[model samples]
Target: MKAVEYRLPKEFDKSFIVFTERGTYFPCPWHYHPEYEFVLVNRSTGRRMVGDHIGYFDEGDLVFMGPALPHVWVNDAAYVQGQAKEEASAVVVHFVEDFLGKNFLSLPELEPLKKVLDLSKRGLVITGKTKKEINRRINGMIGESGLRRLSSLFTIFDILTHSSEYQPLASPSYMQHTQGYYSDRFSKITDYILRNFQHEISLNEVASEANMATTTFCNFFKEHYRMTFVEYLNTIRIGHVCKLLADSDENVVNIAYECGFNNLANFNRQFKRLKGMSPSEYRKTLELQSA
Candidate 1:
């Protein structure tokens, strides 16, 4: 289900927020970007669901997200309960895909960059030593507006284009959803799964909650979501595990059991099925990344 949030772009201008975030460091919920987004997490320790890409992100991480890809940054529950206020600082620049189109990079010049953006459709997260330098450049131009902001957008992209440490977080075939398309019923399903993903969920049980029969509910869900109930549920569960693996010191076996999978073997199989890497390996990658 889609536990999405909506914030319409009020202006039809050629640009938008060329910064990371605003107001307090609150949750953005699961959503998509209509514009190409470049974000650098200066200080963060939560798991992020970016497009189809799911993983744990910490300090010094840069993610390049393509237009309309669904993603969310779920703060560890403890943080939300006023546990840790230090978890803040992220830089995000949102611009139309063709903001400088037909001008800056010709199709031939864009070949390599296009590949980078294509890889980003599923979502790409970069954590490396270059983090400090990029942060430096971004900080140098924090309040930059007008023409300078546009220039900074290109500069941020330039840094990403030349960086070698980034990795694709989601699969290539992942498509994004618009805010208008996500409904309240979808939110209920999402909330239920997040709270109850640790147990077996039957179609009848969920359908009853949605106030529909088993078969009708199945079609209703798939028609709007494009993924079967189980597919969506597993994605949510997998996304959670990716977070637990990175930030928590919990053992893999315990994490699997906690996220609602029946057995360690099944968890490993499914984790690999959705993430293309085993839990331990994914954790190790984060360790090396955050080191």
Candidate 2:
């Protein structure tokens, strides 16, 4: 999908931005910006889209995204409907690569940090111990200013440079295609799917949304997503099912149907295919972790 370019609020005297976002629900749509983003979700459960990658996110979710990498975190429907127990909140930091100076990262001592910045182009899923440590640093940046704030930002880079508990989202193919294609029609299609994935969606419906013939849309989708439209939609649905399994007491069959799966067997197969475990087993793992 084509990402809308969003301008970060300017703070001319400050080199970067660090703030806590709290609200009934996050208001940003699918968008991207020039500044790299460091996000730690302090309280929320929802779906996250970074480039073409679709996944579920819960409290403690952390990600690093480079400049112009499309992304958004949409709070689950409960949050939007004012039914969630906790308000959605996060610690967000934004800064450009040359925020210090164009020559700053070029320095010999900063080369490792510069390399990590480059890797952020595909977006980084900061996980394991690194995720916790980075969250601590990001939380510390709140209400901090002057040299202390800058130090916290640099400390995050230092930790990321030394940590391997991170994975790249957005496939390499999708990242390559993003350099050339930013279609509004694609954006319309993705926005439509995200809003309606809880119900059945058809090939013709999405193709028509793109204003393309089914054959043409298939080729176009493959070129951009490197997967069939159905593959992408199933991935999104399964991601939502994972969230429900972990966060609620919904029955597996009901969760599958609510997530747009009409067939229980197919839902089980797709869930296992995408998550490497059956839905019940996945929930068991989550319970064990909590216990």
Candidate 3:
């Protein structure tokens, strides 16, 4: 109950059109709401963890997650290493299930879209044509009124229902655990890791930062992230390393050291384990890649 951060639209009592200019830290600490969420990560690169899904996300990444589904966007970057952080802004809309109507979902007129929303109960990645329409409609919603706003949202689902371009990201029946004292503790812990992934961050230091016993911290951290504190630390670090691997001309050994990996051999091994490739191999693949 304490997990979901429900910051509804400014005039949510009358309408569900939610819009905000996200700061460098967009949605942090894997929070969800009781409302359906539509987010377009305009042009940006950041860490994305929703439900049990964990990966790096880039510009034009559009995602939808149902109520109380934990998700996060960890981007403290001014730039992707030497390159600039993405220039585009993030657009978001949040609405309750009942905002439209109960039968709106039950109607055969809405079945395909109904199934998509059902899939979105886990999470959804809307791409291709649907992404274009959602982006266009979200932009069009900036100055709309009561009925117009609802109709715009209806149009969004219209695209989702008809488009096979949409993909489900989180597994069916997925549930995210983000409750209690551990939530507060890891909010602090993960926030710190994002802020300091460029350097060495030890479990002891992180536990001290959270003011928790190491063993207790490890257990709690694992429960939330499904990995020990060190593992989560490496996750954040490895992401930065990938940013470097793809965006930088830096040497693999140097990038490893820069990302806080103490030993080169270990860096290569861990990068492979987490990224499915050696550092050099990852870098080579990114050579002149568009995204």
Candidate 4:
């Protein structure tokens, strides 16, 4: 699918830009650009799309996305419908790879930092102690100025470089192919899917959305997303299930149906296939972590 290219605000004269976002919802479409982005979701609950990966994210979601890695954070329907608080917030940092100077990362002493940057090409989700530390540093940068702000940014990078509490978001083979004619077409298809996935989605309807035949649409989707359309739909549904499992005491069968699954057996199978655990097991893990 095609993604929109987003241009970051260019008012900052420094090597990087840092800002805080507070809104009723995360306001961005599926998009990509040439900046390396480090974002911490201080508040919000939703699904995050990174490259071809679809998953759930909540408060304390810290992600480092390398240049041109397409991503977006879509708030749940509650936030969009104003049922939840209107003040969804985040701390975001955007910069180029050579923001420190072209030769900076090339230095032998900066090899570890370089490795972090390279690995971030697939997108990185910082977690555990590393995420907590980076969250503090990011919040600190919101008030600092001049060199102090820059120092806090570097401290985040150093911690990320040294810590193993992170996971890659996208596959190595995933690429942003949304250039020229296919851009809007892809965005329309993905948007429709994300909006209507809770109901019965017919391949015929989605193929028509792309102005392609069913066979052609299937081939095109698999080529670009590396999965069949049904697989991608299930990924999104399972992501929603995860958010409910962590945030609510909803019944598993109820959540499955609410997430658009038709039956418990199928939902359990797909959940286990994608997440490597049964729904109860996954919920237990979350409980253990919180305890």
lDDT (0 to 1) per candidate:
0.67, 0.80, 0.67, 0.80
Tens-digit lDDT track for model 1 on 1-291?
243545546345545655556323545766765677777777656677675455777777677777777677655555656566675768776666666654645667555676567656766776676566667666656677678866765676677678877776753223422221235786566556656777898888899888889999999989976789888777767767776675588998888888788877877888898887888877765554333
lDDT of 4 by residue, 130-182 (tens): 99999999988888888998888878878987898988776433533222113
TM-score of 2: 0.62
**Residues 1-291 of candidate 2: C-alpha lDDT, one tens digit per residue:** 235799878577789988788999888776889899988899999878776566789999999998887788888889989999989999889998788888987799887776677668879999999999899889988878889988888888889989989987864433432222234776677677777888889899999888899999999999987789998888778766766765588899889999899988888888777766788887775554333
**lDDT score for candidate 3 against the true structure:** 0.67
Error of 1 at 240 (Å): 17
Worst 10 residues of 1 by lDDT: 172-181
TM-score of each: 0.56, 0.62, 0.55, 0.62
**Whose lDDT is higher: candidate 1's or candidate 4's?**
4
Tens-digit lDDT string for candidate 3 (76-145): 3564343554443677888777766676667778666656666676577777877888988887786777
Query: What TM-score quantifies how close candidate 4 is to the native fold?
Result: 0.62
Supply the global lDDT for candidate 1. Answer: 0.67
